[model samples]
Target chain A: MKKLLNDPADLVAESLRGVERAHPELRVDHEHRIVYRADAPVSGKVGLLSGGGSGHEPAHAGFVGPGMLDAVCAGEVFTSPVPDQMAEATKNIDGGAGVLHLVWNYTGDVMNFDMAAELAGAETDTEVAAVVINDDVAVEDSLFTAGRRGTGAAVPVEKITGAAAEQGRSLSELADLARRVNDNTRSMGMALTSCTVPAKGTPTFDLPEDEIEIGIGIHGEPGRRRVPLAPAREIAEMLMEPLLADLDFTGGDGVLVFVNSMGATPMLELHLMYAEIAAILDNAGVVPVRSLVGPYVTSLDMAGCSVTLTRFDDELLRLWDAPVAALGLRWGM
Target chain B: MKKLLNDPADLVAESLRGVERAHPELRVDHEHRIVYRADAPVSGKVGLLSGGGSGHEPAHAGFVGPGMLDAVCAGEVFTSPVPDQMAEATKNIDGGAGVLHLVWNYTGDVMNFDMAAELAGAETDTEVAAVVINDDVAVEDSLFTAGRRGTGAAVPVEKITGAAAEQGRSLSELADLARRVNDNTRSMGMALTSCTVPAKGTPTFDLPEDEIEIGIGIHGEPGRRRVPLAPAREIAEMLMEPLLADLDFTGGDGVLVFVNSMGATPMLELHLMYAEIAAILDNAGVVPVRSLVGPYVTSLDMAGCSVTLTRFDDELLRLWDAPVAALGLRWGM
Candidate 1:
């Protein structure tokens, strides 16, 4: 593969070195592979943390800064981080208020974060609370997940919970808020092309040029089905049908529609997809109260897009609009 | 080609619809195919307008907001916008303080924008100034450019000049500052693969799997040469050697190092490349006071990256640090 890397084994660490150099506002723990906000462990403020495999960048590490994640444990590519990394990050970012782990509902990630919480409780006097997010309606189980795999909702979940944490909320309150955000959010993804892992110099999966994988997982896991390639309008219907059926996003304070590029897809296509989705929503009488369109959470060099809809109330909207300085998602600051 | 689009003919207009729907803060004139800041003609603020082909997204249109471009004209994919759109945008955004046209140095773009300036000058009372950016050090003359092809430096030029305009600089002053920023900046791009323009439905150029194009232009124009695929460190050397040779980025107030993805390159690779570039700069005793690493300026789904270094003075640094709320680049607000 023609990737800009020296050694596949050294990819994550070397990339983290660049992240450390590029963002002075963040502190990187090279040994443990943890990225922490420089001013982490805010006095008496709830500490927020989230992480998964490293390929879905700007998710955990890029979200570390003021008004977002306090720390993140990055794993190797699509592999889960060890419990030791998470436990160390939890201990370090724990303020007097406590620490909250926002775990995406991948089987390995959930298990590891659980073990990390247990380790933190046994070692330090930190109160660790965990919230598991399972918002992907693509499948009930995948190759790497036993339940519905968490996909795009991690963004809004982290943003809203981090805002609540920045407001000095308790660990339990942040946990509840995160769970609420996840419950209200639904995401579905499709892939036109598969991404290649650095370790495996070939694409993670094979996708013919004339076909696509609908409801595909972020890590090239098996999706609902493979379908013939179609226009964005049809693709939007394929993604939105299950999402609307799974969640009641028609009423309340409207929905926060997030149209994200899955790495290789350009903004032109993402915006075109957004217009198709927005047209569908408009016809369905679903008002989009807030919208985010870009590549926030992405697979590595995967050509596709995902749609996440969060039914937001005033509180969630307020928190989303709050000033944030994270590299992945920054606004109002 | 796999892309999320309906019809290639309707791509630009449809995507602009998505942009208008997604960002309520920006207003889009569908008839003129121009994106404008919602509060255009900001009393006495000098207007900043930039545009070119549609494929290089988040360039001109995405930069329309506070502390950035006041208006942007959109052309078809990889095609220069006509003079009518630019003239209409100029007439609308003029706040009685005149307007500045930020033109990328492409043959069609330079010619069309020149005609637009004349049209605006003769038809309206608005004074107009122009700054043509030609920061690419790839070649003295290329397929579509006379001197140099504008590449990654459009971001900083628009940013610094936009900030100056926000600070109430006159039209002539903004034009001078833009030109100064352009003169101090140098950029070089290398592509691992070729991009597919939506209309063509084929790769812009042929790139074998084992080789890469160094010193590639943003629009898939012929680069310096095709070379065997190398590691990120060696690739960084290839990109940096020419940039440093062309511009003396040492001394003064240091340099602003920008590592940008040419669309398909992920943050993981971009950050890794940034580390490699940083090490080279460190060895060269070139201090980087500010840095931007991401896909700010991009080609459509081309797997590659470009590096830009601008020698910044205290004034330029201050303006660079100013708050910007554009969709493409947002921080310090």
Candidate 2:
């Protein structure tokens, strides 16, 4: 409950106010809780819209900029945004090329984005297509998801697909590319501690001091199991086993290895974990052509880390390397 | 401690190994524990060397890259790096134009870096100038410092001076510019809970559940006082009042407002806190020309944040805006 917030109800709105001020390149629709690039609707460029709960920050809202998302509809912490917010954002960011919805594979998010796409299509002449990402290999079904929970892969998916969109790709092409990125990407998460929602003012679940939850979902969903705390080396194995099994990441153009912090995990530990994961990859003959290590997508204050691997082709690699100016992920610009 | 580490003794080295693996742009010397730009000794550019204890990550080591730092010496967790490491880094990065040692104001760090500068001076033909940063306005003298603790201002000092160095500023000129940047910057941190060092396996200090330590140091040193936890608005006032009182951030080319998380504070909370801080700045007529909100400087897993305001002139502003590709801070490149 020791959070830097005024009221739980005002968290998302107030934070958006700060985002608006901190990044002048972004314009926040405070009323609808939509964050859009200041120069959104870039003529013939397809609009890229993605969103989910607010707690997983730098995900939906922070990714809004020139090379990434055109707009993002932010919901309350750990809750899906209403369809109205998404529909409004879609209409606003849509250019002549059309709009693409990057929906993370959560039941609530998928349903809402679907409804939003329908609403946008009915209300405006905007062509909308949705690509649902389910890259988390941690669980087949979880508390908030029917299939695999989309976790860290959203970062690479958004980056690669957004880069393609910036190149004036058609909406269908962008959707296909997003799906291809998701198909090649796999993620697994484990938590050292549960995060406390500001509204609840308590940890979502109780984890013993000496235990950790493996294969955990972003919103404290029950994972594969709890186990006694182990070293980071073992933890990396537990995470990598499922990821490598779920996806063939050995060949092609190698892989983009991402070691993400689930909020409270420091960069030092993330780097350490990356070394462990890299060592494992080396043993498995998996070459990591590119690597990202940091807290790009995160749960609120959960002290944990996640591993994501995307087996990339030359095209996906090129798109990943393209310039991106989003607050969440920025490089090559 | 619930840290994702194998052995506390090997934490720094293991993390550095991961750093080396993750960022191919930077080269890490495992023996000396120095992280240097892959292209160190950049012909004639003055070498920018900064280092401190570990734990306050993305500080010295993460800043090693183009338009930032030439090299960084890393110490053990919350422990000062030895003179040998600093001396070795100095010799390697010196490009005949000379080397500048950026020392945070902790006693151990300043003494060690001063010794390293002397060692480099006596051992090699490399000219070295030192700039000691003591930007924390929390106290006149605290636990590990004589004047002010170099808290969050190392980022701006390194950035501005690093940019100047990249522009071919001489060692002495870079030293002067770094000192100027440090003088104009002021920072104050607060902690809601104490952080646990991996070796220590316990909280650094005892902080009750309902209270927070204002003006807290990054290393969990005693702050001004412990007060009952207040709303983010009041907390912002508590942090800003002292910063504003110590210096007039109202005029000039405005200020560079940086709100840094101490580690565990989530981006959602950080953004909300930024809103509170921005409103206070607006009321005080402190026009923030630039703002960086995130966990750039951190204290392991402590749950809190710090605010830094660097009163900028045109030159400093230009330097701050320069492209930096460091892993810790990257933009406009």
Candidate 3:
């Protein structure tokens, strides 16, 4: 409730305004709440778009740029963007190479993006493809998602698929690559503190200070279970074991590791967590080809971290090494 | 208290271990608590070095790379690094072009870095120049500081001076440029909640759910005042007015606005605050040529932000735009 916001209802619009101003590299449609790359609709290149609630910043919006998402639609905090906004973004992003919609595995987001695909198809002749991401191993299903909730895997999915798309991959090719990345990726997260939704003006959930929640989702939805607080060593093991088991990560065929901060967590802790994760993976003989540690995807102001490991091949590693220029994750461009 | 740490005593060493594992681009000295460029002593270039307490992450350590600081010494959380570590980093970073030590304005840091300069000079024959940054406009003097506390401006100063050093500026020239950047910059911050040091294992200060501390330092030191919680707009004004009054950010010479998060603050709130700050500067007729919004300089897990504005000219602007490659803040490299 102690957020630095004006009217809670204006959170999305005001933050979008802030995003537009802070990053002249992007353009914001205030009405539809769609953030688009200033130079969108690249000829002969597939358009990439992702949309979701506003709280997990640097996600969909931060991913909009060259070699990544062409457009991102913003919704209210922890709420999905409507079909209208996605449709508009789809229309603007398509440059005849087709449009790819990266939909997280949330029910509202999936349905809205589906409706947007139809509307965009009807309104324009541009072919559209949808790649659903649901890599979170936190739960079998959740209140917000039918299966696993999409979490930190979206970052690399966006980046790798973006690189593939930039290499003139077709809609189907990009869709397949997206799915491959998603299938090869697994994520698990824990929360030391819950985040408050601005409009609700309170924490989404309650817990005593001494305890922690294991397998927590991005939206403060109920996780698998609650547990007593543990040190970074034990916590990193708890998070990493599920991910390594889900993916047969072994030997020299290394994986790309992403230790994402679930908001309100410091880089110090993230680095500490990353070190523990590296040590754990090293002990298992799993080499980390690439490592990223920071808050790329988050749950508002939640205090925690998530560990994501994406199985990598030569092609995937090459694609992952591709340059990307986005507000959320930019490098080598 | 709810930190993902192994032991309170091992936080600094553990985090540095994690840092070395996560980033292959830098080398960490566990014994001396120093993080240096993996490829140090770039032939004829002036070596840039910055160090301080460990808690303010991505600061000195994260800035160690090709175009930034050649090495960074990490001390215990919120405490100044020892003179031995600085002297060792100074000796290692010297590339025959001398070493430039960027010290934050703190009683302990200044005293220690000054000793490091003498030691480095006598032992290694490395001519070291030290630049003490005191850019915080929040307080003229505080408990931890003899004069103004160095805060958010260190980011720009390191970045700009690093670029100058890479461009073959000597130690004296880099020192002068560092001083110019320090003088031209002004910063003010506020906190909605206090940070918890791992050792202390408690909130740095107490606050009711409804109040905020204005002009809070990076160490949770006292600021200008504590006032009732205000909206993002009013709070933006409170931080910006003092900075604007301090710097003559005028026409043709747009200032670089760095809206830094005080750890634990979400980018959503930072972006929202950035919009208000942009509007405020627009109303004041001062153009912001460059803007960076994120948690660059942080107090361990404090929930708030600081606004830094650095007046820039053509050369400094070019230097600001130079490529930097680091784990914390990497771009254009």
Candidate 4:
């Protein structure tokens, strides 16, 4: 395994140091590896927190700012953050109102955040609410493998709900908003190349260069199946078929499409994929109300892309239309 | 030169079509790859517009929601959005309010956004104010090249200033706030491995396994220099010394730090770096008010990280505390 650091063990700690040095407006609890917006406990405002394993960029941490998450606990690369880390972030960011945890549906993430919530509850009066985002349409939502792995849609839920919270909405309202956003959305991704976790120092899987993995998870987990690389048109169908079948957009209220590139895919290819994907959605009698292309939520250096659809109702549309000013997504503010 | 793409030239166009189809709420002008929030020309609010090259995920487009940007134009991967694209986006998103073009400090982005602003002025009463974010402190302010490239700090500027605009602040006030955020920020980055642009289908540069490139740009551009792989502690020094020399954070209010992953750097490493970086800042007597460490702005798949610092005053801090909802960065709302 070729890398540029002194030791593999020091990777996470060292990266956190670099982050602290770079963004002074944020406070990094070095021991906890929690990224928090400097001004915490915005008196009277509820705290919003989210986290998961490392490897996904701008997620969790980058989303920590005003109108989004107050704190984000980052675990080791592709590993969930510890309970202590999440507890620290919660205690630090929780205003008098309470603290809400919006976590993705991963075994480690779910278990760890749950532990943190308990710790936070035991430690303080910061009312804690947990909302797990399970919007990925890839995995069958059965009592198996911690349900569907949360992919791209967690970002929008965090942003929208974070904004609602920022508007001084009650904790219950914020939790409801988060659930609504999660309910309205669904996502699925495919990987063209397996990613090499720096810690593991090896590709997660072995597939020939010409083959692509369908329905892959964000952490380089095996997808539903591996298939030969095909034309862009066919590839778009392969991605959208399951996604379309999983949800019904026939009511025609319009849908928000996010064509997200995994780390290595370029916008050029993303756009091509978008074109073909658009044709499919058009044929499905779905009106595209909001469209987001390019990479928002991403996995490490894996060459692939995910398609996310959020069926927007009037209320959801209003929230989507409402101005937001977070780090990753901002518009009309 | 290994990549999975059909045709290089069709990259941008195809991706835009896909984005358009996926997002029914966003209108995509195929003739010019510009995307606007479906509810654009946001009534009675100053129009905020931002765009640049395509590769920076969740950037300009991902930022197009309420209180952030009104419109975003997409260029080819790692290339600036063209004048026509920006002009159309500006026009469509403008609601008779003056338009503000907040862009990163790249030559192509500056030139193209400038052209779009000029066209925008000729067509309508919409006054266009442009501000380029050049926060990277690595490059000395000289006549040769564009001074310093904007890095992670751009995210906060959009959020904070977008909130100000959302509150019906005058265009000049919004511009001033943006300038303050720009002036108070600095960033420097290093790359461990050169990334391959999808269209180019080749590595951006050659680096031996033992080497690391410092002061690199987001597009996998060559850094200021390359050196043998070293300990994270030493790398922290390499990235921080130049930044410290660029500004005097001594006896200041505080600073905000952002440790940005250049796409492929794992999260574990990011946190490890953050611990060391926090120590360095503490030793420098600079109180770090806040810090954000993660991959917010990214290159396609470069394995490296960047450091960004923004000196914070009370007012700017208050604005930073505002809530925002967007795809990439969400908090404080």
Best by the DockQ measure: 2
A97-213: candidate 4 lDDT, tens digit per residue: 888899888887888889988998898866888898998777764322477778788877887787788789888888888988888788888888877777788888887867888
TM-score of predicted chain B versus true chain B for each candidate: 0.99, 0.99, 0.98, 0.92
Query: Residue-wise lDDT of candidate 3 within B1-333, one digit each (tens)?
Result: 898889989988988888888888889999999999999988899998888997887786888897788998998999999999999989998889999888899999999999999998999799988899999998888989999999888898999998888889788888999999999899999999999999999998997888899889999999998889899999998998888888688865689989988988888989999999999999998888898998899998999999998888888899998888977677886
Question: Distance from true position, residue B3, model 2, in Å?
Answer: 1.5
Q: Give the B-chain TM-score of model 1.
A: 0.99
- Give candidate 2's TM-score: 0.99
Q: Write the per-residue lDDT of candidate 2 for residues A213-319, one digit (tens) a residue.
A: 99999999999989999999999999999888887787799999999889999998999999999999999999988999888889999999999999989999999
Residues B197-271, candidate 2: write the lDDT tens digits: 999899999988899999999899999999999999999999999999999988799999999999999889898
Residue pairs whose backbone atoms clash in candidate 3: none
| Candidate 3 residue-wise lDDT at A225 | 83
Q: What is the C-alpha lDDT of each candidate?
A: 0.92, 0.92, 0.89, 0.76
Tell me, what's the RMSD of every candidate? Answer: 0.8, 0.8, 1.0, 6.5
DockQ of 2: 0.84
Question: Which pairs clash (backbone N, Cα, C closer than 3 Å) in model 2?
Answer: A333-B333
List candidate 3 segments past 4 Å from native. none
> Which regions of candidate 1 deviate over 4 angstroms?
none
After aligning candidate 2 to the native by TM-score, how far in Å is the CA of B262 from where it should be?
A: 0.2
Local accuracy of candidate 1 as per-residue lDDT tens digits, A151-220 = 8899999999988898898888899999999999999999999999999999999999999999999999
Report how closely model 3 matches the true complex, as a DockQ value: 0.83
